[model samples]
Target: MESNYHTLKRNYNQLIVITHLTQLLTYITGFGGLVVPLIIWATQKDRVEEMDAHGKSILNFQLSILIYSIISIPLILVFGLGIITLILIAILAFVMPIVNAIKASNGELPSYPLSLNFVS
Candidate 1:
């Protein structure tokens, strides 16, 4: 019974970590930032409420960042401001999810600044 509980806890933690880190797939698949979490959240949301919350938060952040990146493209022709904006987007995309994953692992609710509630 004790071992079973430990296994369950470990699996729960794994799911939480995966939910946050799967956004890294965006680098490979281009749209994985939203697609991966959407898939995972759809599959696991019923099994784990925490995953649902994490999924919504991640989706909101990803959507917000996507919009910001798109808006920055025009600035590239302006004063090279788009270059800096792109760099910041890349940094935020790479770092914010990891920070949120760490917080999720420790059973804390993670909040992404600049995230808009697209998923509720």
Candidate 2:
């Protein structure tokens, strides 16, 4: 007999929302914004509804922020433009997770702007 484990799924909206909010860990402990959500997604995607989509969006957004920050470092020498870019990136990084967490709570998939498709 085949096991039904693969077909089992649960509606865990709170967990999904928590996954989105975990991205803010970077602001608090200076890291784990990516690692924490990644662990939750990896371990729960098969069991939780919408975990895959939310996880992918969060990872892509975080990766994009890292890339943007790296590129901005070079721009800092060019009339200090990188400073502005970094500030905008920081704001986006700080705000989007909270907004998406609310969306997740409402059963909506995350929509992270300017996020590159790194996972899909």
Candidate 3:
């Protein structure tokens, strides 16, 4: 029983890492950033409490980024500010996920600044 519990715990930890890192998929699928984490969270949330919490955090972060990007679209008319906003968003999308994944791997809850609670 103890071994089973250990295995379960290890699996949960792996899921947490995945829940954060999977956002990188957005670079390829163009939309997988949110979809992949959503799928994993939806499926594993009930099975593991950690997956549920981390999944929500990841989803909320992605949703917040999406909202910010959408709002920046109109800035294109204002001295090309939208271009800069988009570039920053791109960089954030790339860097933040890896940072969060590191935190997850270390058994810490990762929080994203500017992330709105869209899932919770």
Best by TM-score: 3
Best by lDDT: 2
The TM-score obtained by model 3 is: 0.92
Q: In model 1, how large is the Cα lDDT of residue 53?
A: 84
Candidate 2 achieves a global lDDT of 0.90
Worst 10 contiguous positions by lDDT, candidate 3: 48-57
lDDT of 1 by residue, 1-120 (tens): 999988887798789888899988888888888898889888888887488788889989999999999999999998789999999998999899999999998888878988878888
Worst 10 residues of 2 by lDDT: 1-10
Q: Per-residue alpha-carbon lDDT of model 2 for 9-116, expressed as tens digits?
A: 224888888999999999988778999999999998887878999999999999999999999999999769999999999999999999999998787889999999
Please provide TM-scores, in order, for all candidate models, with all chains considered together: 0.91, 0.89, 0.92
In TM-score terms, candidate 2 sits at 0.89
RMSD to the true structure for each prediction, in A, is 1.4, 4.6, 1.2
Which ranges in model 2 have alpha carbons more than 4 Å from their true place? 1-11
